[model samples]
Target chain A: MDFFQTIIALLESTIRLSVPLIFAALAGLYTERAGVFDIGLEGKMLGAAFAAGAVAAVTGSVFIGLLAAILISVLLSLVHGYASITQRGSQIVSGVAINFIVFGSTVILGEAWFRQGGRTPALSGDARFQTWDLPFADAVKDVPFIGPIYANLLSGHFLLTYLAFALVPISWWVLYRTRFGLRLRAVGENPGAVDTAGISVIWLRYRAVICCGILCGFAGAYLSLAMNAGFVKGMTAGKGYIALAALIFAKWRPVNIMLACLLFGFLDALAIRLQGNPLPLIGQVPVQLMQALPYILTVILLAGFIGKAIPPKAGGIPYVKER
Target chain B: MSNPYAKLPNWAEYGLIPLVNLVVAFLVAGLVVLLVGENPLNAAYHMVNGAFGRGEYIGFTLYYATTFIFTGLSVAVAFHAGLFNIGSEGQAYIGGIGVALACLWLDRTMPWFVVFPLAIIGSAAFGAMWAFLPGWLQAKRGSHIVITTIMFNFIASSLMVYLLTRVMKPLGSMATQTRTFEAGGQLPKLDWLLSIFGLNIGNAPFNVSFLLALLAAFGVWVLIWRTRFGYELRTMGHSPSAARYAGISETRITIIVMMISGGLAGMMALNPIMGEQFRMQLDFVQGAGFVGIAVALMGRSHPAGIIPAAILFGMLYQGGAEIAFEMPAISRDMIVIIQGLVILFAGALENMFRPAISRAFASFGQRSAAVQTKGA
Candidate 1:
């Protein structure tokens, strides 16, 4: 592909690559806005993927596995909430503990049950997220300037890919239009005020985290079940972290978060495509540099070029009743 | 609602909440071990034995601990300045690449003694540079170091992987590694002692890297306590606004500490690269920089406390591999389980021990009086 085509290809691929991240980033937003820092997004996502993949592989039921994965992940999220939010423990410390517990347990169980080294067996067609082709997608795929791009790019994708995009609008509405949304935001930015106003801090934060956990579960399931068809060791591989970057980059706005995830996803997709690809003068750029793109951009964004975005005032701080 | 009439336990004054947490963790860890069918005491015994039973094992454990010292010091130094450094992994990576490049460039012309120092300094400089960017961002724009540093680590690791795989591919073997360093680039050994025992220190990769690690720890301790800069760092860490009112520049301390922290992280390469490895292979730091967080936390950011913590962690790491090797199917993973448990328990100690200290400090009268007071 020429430079123009590659750029176009990059944009298209970014959207595709960013689907899972969009889910995760928005998931992070919900929790962070509710005054809880969900550092265990990585662990939650990983655990969910393993559950989903394992169930899918065994039962040949993709939806069931995904649901089970979401449920299990929700439980883990609640545990995290209990530790960090309810118990008023250290957020980072609690996150680190949860990650380890999930990581090691997953590997241990994987070995004992699957006889595989920290990976689940891949699913067959019946068990996997079956890709659906949009009608007329192929006919216009090769039409001309925009035809091939749209057809080749946007036509075929897993069902979750569409859901990830749809979630942007849904998240915006849920965060802004609803009573729960106001309470959630109020709890995060000023929990004391919310508490004085007669709202329960723990319950609101708990509800928000549970929502985040469910979203992260879907994102995790999409990762292995949709993309790779199985869960591998360290499968999340810090994607949850990147989702956090996207979350911060978006300034906790659902719409902005979608853009940030897409940007990162684009960088990631470009990097993957660049691997072993012949370049005129660059002698094929190392994909590692490509992989590093999102982080570099994150660093740039976080360093304050972006306009002021205040985090929820009460975020990550445990409320202790000083009677 | 009428509970205000009751006295606050004098012990409850401090963060007594987190103290009880530690005891619960120990119980959890012990129970988990029991479920796995190993006696917790025997497991603890094996842990102790694996780390220090043999001098050579101590050597192995210390070698691992040496790298952690740099990483832990990196974390502690930043924490002292009130910056969370999740980017030590990247800084260490940069330092690794810096050392490799230095060896590649200077080893041919410079003597072993000269080249070795240059490599160490070069690594530190690279590590410092790593912190500089994030520090600049933090100071200039008030960015969050926790998120930024974590992001930097990813970029650094990915870049390293790409560099090794494609750009810096060694001449002979087409592996994801660079060429081995020349002999002169290696750190000078305490070969005299090993020669006295007539043991093959040559066969074993143990060297004077551990001593350097200890010296760095001492230097960091002195730097943190005895210096004006350290005072500022500690002040800022406690409260940035208070430090600001005290005329201490918070930004200056953040930048300085981040740079210093990164440099310390940079020195971590001395343990592996200059010792037995003599080259940067994949996973050169071997996640030690990441584990250093746990080490730093468990040690409560004290240089002296970190020594034991780092060594303890190193023991589990070595023991894990050994068990996995010996048992075949039994699992070396127990070591990681224990390590994770240790971190969890240590964090809980803050909740566990502080209440006792608080109770010991407060009088019963004052505790009871404070309890009855209503509005601020």
Candidate 2:
């Protein structure tokens, strides 16, 4: 019984970890689909995390915090969009500049304001998001393998975990089912074509990138509020970048992106778990080997030895209107 | 749209253009000092004195310049082949691992000569392997190199944290760092050479790595300008279609160039490994690769031009660290601001210099850059 419960706990933990990754990856997909490479996802997320944490801590309102996070990151997206879209600058440089600006700004501000050494004051428990159990979760507490897994592993995950899953299908619908989706795809492939077709390329890319920023804001908030309950300096670390790799591995597809996030989350969880659990027969591997799993897997996947993946053609090529 | 090149004196085209890039870079750096509320003149004076005025400071500046040389060469190599391999941070991580693992495993058995070369080769190989992925992806799968390189850096950092904390743990302490390397693995200093030249070489960590860095830069310059391989790379970067029509294999060139780029950047570990650190360390790259991007940009991605750029950046960085001592309000991160502004300006240089050279300006706005403005 204990063994079964452990598996359930493992799966739920995995889902919780995968949520922000899924959101960030899907967010990246929207921008890349519109030919705007969104490397500033990290900056936008970090900016939002600070914005939300500061607002929530001051006002004691999670909803207002979420709204503030979204709005601030949207502003960041505009800077990213403005520099890349209007100025005809290199997207990579612009993206990197944005990341540097946010990373430094957050640290500098956090130090200057609260003087807490680049960490925001922790949110009170009442101000935090509560993890609600799903309906019928307790009724199947005794059902064999699948029952324990579903009830214990899947039942009590954060609200965002389930939302992240739902986003996959919804994103699929938006990308493939809507008129704007078609225009985004057209922009990514060849903005010249979209321009000739009478849709404004700059406007479409702007919206696509803005949506990415908003989603990334929630993703950052999830990191602080949902997972860890507070923010620390470089807390997001480079997870934003890893999410981007997953975005590429999925080839900009929504459903595939969800799967990729879960896989990465699985590796992450296994790394954490190996410290206590180890393996059944092989005994304990070194912690280095366990933590190295994600990097090793990423290298193998990216080596193109497994298979091929193609990026959108117009990706990173800033659309200059005068031309 | 008029041809400014048609009217400019020949010196204006070649000498003034490159000189202006340098002047503009320093101006931006000065602006950062002004923003940080330091006297730009005093800071600039301090920076000059701290880097080259005194022997001790010059030595310290050289230590900083050594690492930049390797990374700057790395960026320049990739720029030549038109690949943006930002994975230098990760490659440095992997190479640090390689250097650490090799030194620990083989310290007892091998002689100094054999062990040192093996350590360098191993480091280079691991860094090359790190670069090989984005290279292959760009070659075979059409993946964006910039994005992939960024991903690798994160993965490398995570894995390094785990490794240092776990498998590569130093023998005695609890810090998340590897054990020190054997004395045989240490980099030998040429302070003896400094003394031979009767230069005040006291207390400078100057080592043989400087020579190695210069050689690598020269090698890269040769590779890009003096070889058939380099000829193809330049052609491909300027116009991939033209290179393809001329029978060049874009995929092969890209993979090779990226591997070389990563390998050269990986060599940066030698300075750390053979010098004071004397073993692998976490945060080893310390944004050297990222700074190399600015260095490469400031150098206009030209290999020969990178040496002075590297030295200048080295001076700025070393000086920035000292600013905290002289002024409490400012921090070393002022270097980052300077870097960002320079990169922003350099990348968009066409705006400032291009319009300045227009024929329409030949009438009144400006004349011959060297003589006409002087007479006016």
Candidate 3:
């Protein structure tokens, strides 16, 4: 019974932890699918987190903060688009620059505005995203097994968390079923073909990038407004890169991305749990091993030790119309 | 039929365009300063005074520049082979392990010079080894170096944290770092060298690493431009198919270039570890690996450009610290904004002004030609 409760608690933590990864990975999915590889997902998410936290603190409204987050992330995404798509620059360089820019600008602006050493004031009341209680959560809490699974494991979460899980199927449907999705995929695989088919590849890529911006905004909002009380300097840490790794581990597939994120999230939750705990055979488990597992697995996957994770054919290459 | 914009002269290509981009980047940074409600000119004054006003300030700037030069060359060397070695951060981190091991083991027994050479070899070998898998995978298994290197960075960080906490930390010590090194591990300060100019680098961490960095820059210049292998590397970078047709082994070149890059990155540990801290501590690399990318990009991957670009960045680092001290509103992160702008303008948007400048130069040349012909 204790083991069962522990497992449920770990799973719940995993769900909460995986929310940001899902949003960022899905963001990368959209952008990469449109042939623009955005390593700046980290930067965009970070900028959005700062914007959401600062605006929420100022306006006392979570909705306005979300809007500001999306707006800021989208602006950053457009800068990336201008550099990578229109200017035909190196996508990686542009992405790297964006990361540095956002990383620096967030702290600079935060300090200037708040006088809080690169942090917004602690949010409270309506300024933060409150978790939602699913229907019958209270009634089902007393029941066993399935009751705990439904109520404890799945019930209490931010609205964005539920939306993140829902977006997985929505993303799959959009990518596999919609014409826009086909064009976006086509652009990633072969932009020339998409262009030859009378579609403006540039416009398609811009739209995809915008979608990435919107999703990254949600990820940022989830980080500051939900998972955390306020924006802390370098709060995103390497979650964006981990999301990228997860995206690759999942082979850019929507449903697979969620699973990969969950696996990583589980590792994160386990790492926290095993900090001082000693196992039977292994004795005291080093938390760093768990922290490093996702990256090591991703690298192994990339090296084809497990299986190959091939990226989009035209992912990093800037599209150039042959004269 | 003569299109002036089609063919650029050497001066304009290397000098004018970079200058314009740099100026634009600085302008954008200045705008940010203004937005923060500070006088841009006043901030600039403070930054310049902070970086270069005193001998110690110069020492600190050069010390920072020393690290940048090594990492910058690391990036440049790999870049010339068309390999983006993003794993330098990881390589440098692991290289710290090498330096730590060498200093810990040999510092008590050997002299400073003997330990220095061994430390260099240890750092280079370990850093190279850390990068070898990614390079090998790229060459042999078609794995992307960028993603693999980025992953390696996280792994390296985790490994370091574990090592520092569980293994390296002196028994019963509260800190996460290893014990300070003996005399053999310490790099002598360059005060004597600075004294020649009637200056003292008082309390600055500036040391022999600065000279080693300059030497490395020279070595890189010779390697990239004067060596037969460099010719082949450049061939592969410019046109891989042509390189293959020319009988250059793609796999060999890729792996070797990555190792060289990794080795260069690994050497960056010498400055901070042996020269400054004299002990292995966590987070010592401190994003210098990423700064190298910016330095290499701004420098056009040439040693001649990299040296000055590194100094510029060093000035930014030292001076920005001063700005943060003087101004209550502006923070040190302001330097990060400028660094980002520099990368954005000089790297990604490098050609933003090319068309207009080429057109102007082209028309100007045409008019001069017309005048010369008329004179003739």
Per-prediction CA RMSD (Å): 5.4, 4.5, 1.7
Off by over 4 Å in 3: B1-5
Q: A21 in model 2: Cα distance from truth in Å? A: 0.7
Worst 10 residues of 1 chain A by lDDT: A303-312
User: Model 1: what is its DockQ?
Assistant: 0.43
**Deviating ranges (above 4 Å) for candidate 1:** A1-13, A133-155, A278-284, A306-309, A321-323, B1-46, B105-112, B166-173, B188-204, B330-339, B352-376
lDDT of 3 by residue, B1-376 (tens): 1222466898888888889999999999998888889999999999999999999998999999999999999999999998888788889989988888999999998988999999999899989999889999999999889899999999999999999998999999989899999999999999998889988898889999889889999999998899999999999998899999999999999999899899999999999999999999999999999999999999999999999999999999999999999997888888788888888999899878989998898899999999999999
What tens-digit string does per-residue lDDT give for candidate 3 at A229-289?
Answer: 8899989999999999999999999999999999999999999988899977989889999
Task: Give per-model TM-scores.
Answer: 0.87, 0.85, 0.98
> Which candidate's lDDT is highest?
3
Residue lDDT tens for model 1, B1-376 = 1222234454453224323544455567557566545566666566577656665665667677778888988999988887878788889988987788888887777777777778788899999998898898889887777777888888788878878876787766777887878876677666565557663343445667677788889998999999988898999888888999999987788888999999999988877887877778888876777678778876678888788778767877765665555444336556545555555555522444444555554566667778779433
Winner by TM-score: 3
Score chain B of each candidate by TM-score.
0.83, 0.89, 0.97
Docking band of candidate 1: acceptable
Q: Per-residue lDDT tens digits of candidate 2, residues A1-323? A: 78766766766677887888898888889998999887878877888888777777777877787788889888878877776776556677766766766776666556545667777778976556778787888888677887777677778767667778888999999999999999999899999889998889989999998999889888888777678666677777766776887887776788889888888787777777777666989987766665555555655666655565577889888786543
Deviation (Å) of B191 in candidate 2 = 4.3
Separate DockQ for every predicted complex: 0.43, 0.24, 0.67
Q: Write one digit per residue (lDDT tens) for candidate 1, span A1-323.
A: 47767777777778777988998898888889988887778888888999998899889999998998899889988877877776566676666667776776677566656878878997878789987788888778777777766666776788989899999999899989999999999888888788888889888889998999899889989988898879997798888888988898888999999988988888788778877786678687767777777777777777666576566777777766555
State which candidate, 1 or 2, has the greater lDDT: 1
